[model samples]
Target: MNVVKRQIDLKRMFTCTTFADRVRFLIELAVTAPSTHNSQPWRFVITQESCRLWFEPKKQLKEADPSSRDLFISLGCVLENFVVAAQYYGMYKEVRLHMKENFVAEVFLYDRAAAHQEEYRSLCESILKRYNARGLFERTNIHEATLKRIEDIAQKYTEQGVRLQVVQNSTDIKNVAELTAKGIRIARSKPLFRKEFAQWFRTNLSKKQDGIPGYAVGLPLLPSFIAPFLMRYCSLAKVLVRKNTESILTAPAVCVIESDTDSPETWLQVGRLAERVMLECYAHDLATSIYVAAIEMDNMSQELAQTLELRGRPQFLFTCGVPLTNHRKFTPRLSVDLVLK
Candidate 1:
């Protein structure tokens, strides 16, 4: 399918005459959730009144995320989108998390009037509009009200032991930026890591349905084609470190998402919280860029938690602000038919 048609399909809310059709429509929104490297590491089995979500082990990033932490977190993003879309249509019943089974989550559906339907409907709209903003951000601090609103959204997840900490102080932000630069350098030093990451980088004109396109990161046609080769064989660590550090410093604030525990279930919850926060930011005309290298590495994560005086384990990190340039080109997604079981 072409880009325009795919966008329309994702944005359209099809009228459904059956429960299965409703579930399928919701899955269209669910797949729009971001994944590490656009791996889209998930599968779904649709039924008459429910949908089962499973983690696809084959899509796991072995060198980049060997513990499957990011994979489970990616699944959490899928769950959040599915539930948000369901509530918009008044078809969400409840969702049960499965730890011991092959499926990670099973969402039950029922046809009825939904509470806060308008609220969720707005968020559902954001599912299609939201994108990972990259490059330099505007050099202005976020409004106090906007920051409070984001904090309130994060507060809702506190009982679940997930917290979102926003760092705006110049000193703290600079410290975090240094840690991020150091972490990226360490991660890229490994040959296996570079090779694994290269496999997901695609040229701008390529037609692959899943993977990060060159344009999404401001790469031109020629550079996009050579990105994989450069990443695998070239020592671009110093350049990457400088670029990432500058980007972090330019942002208004650095947000850190933490969980009280480290498990698949908590990781899922963190993912949900992270996605909701991103949507909320986009709703306010703000852009967010996720930077997880510091949080993904154990030593870096430990140092980050200490620097921020955080009480829980940090699961995700990102920067949010007005963007110097808007990123309209979206990363590709695997079709619902391709991901269905």
Candidate 2:
């Protein structure tokens, strides 16, 4: 089946008049949020007036994400997208975080009359347009005004203890690129890591609902078919390191999302902040690519913290710029019915 067919038609979402139907529409947008390897590690239980978001442990990447950091962050992205969609439709009442339970959050909705803000509308619209740009980025630096707007967005999250740090200096960018290369080498050197990653690496013709499809990484048909097996058995550390390093170096800047603590709550907050920042960038006609290797490896997070001289622990890393190509490709998402509990 064509993976693009998995995306819901937004026109149908607009036709949803009932509270439950609107909530369902918002959930559809929520699932489009990016996750590690497109794992979509989340579930939802919906009621007439509310929806609860849960962390689906069965979808977790055990070997690649031993700390469950990426899992919680992925949940945060879903929460942000849901909230954005709610605001766009004016169905959002409030949300409560349940850090102590497997269910991460509960969002309450109402049919109260409201006007949609331009910002929320733009963010919601970008939900479908946004994709993790995986190829090389153009050499142009992000305009100062665009950078300032993104910084302002980050400032609003300070009360939640999350900060977005942008690194544009060539020296600093190279430093991060080197650390990320080292981290990739360390990760792919382990047989288990490769095996786990291979499971989620899908070929272009795959029918699976969740996972990173080969085209997203510029893989052709034959290579995509062979990539999983190659990753599972062979050490591609050197090749991967070179490719990733080059991609990072070519970008004009790197962004690091940091939090005051390293707990699940902080991770969720970082994810929300990261998704918002990414959407804001997309609204300004820019693309983003996420890189977690540096933050996922041992001691590397601390080294990254010191290198960037950040006041808090770094939880997420990504780079944004004008991509080399305008053609966008998306990873497949499971249907809302399939994810409902």
Identify the leading candidate in terms of lDDT: 2
The residue-by-residue lDDT of candidate 2 on 1-341, one tens digit each, is: 01122346656765776767777777888899999889999989988679999988798888888989999999999999998888876778899999766889999987642566565877877787778876688889999999999999899989988999999999988989999998998998899898899999999999999998888888888999999899889888888888888889888889899888888888898999999988888877788889999999887999999998999889999998888876446788988898888
Which residue pairs in candidate 2 collide?
none
Q: Against the unseen true structure, what C-alpha lDDT does each candidate score?
A: 0.84, 0.85
Where in model 2 is the C-alpha error above 4 Å? 1-9, 112-116
RMSD values, in order shown: 2.9, 2.7
How many clashes does the backbone of model 2 have?
0
Q: Provide the lDDT at 293 for model 2.
A: 91
* Per-model TM-score versus the true fold: 0.94, 0.95
Error (Å) of candidate 2 at residue 311 is 1.6
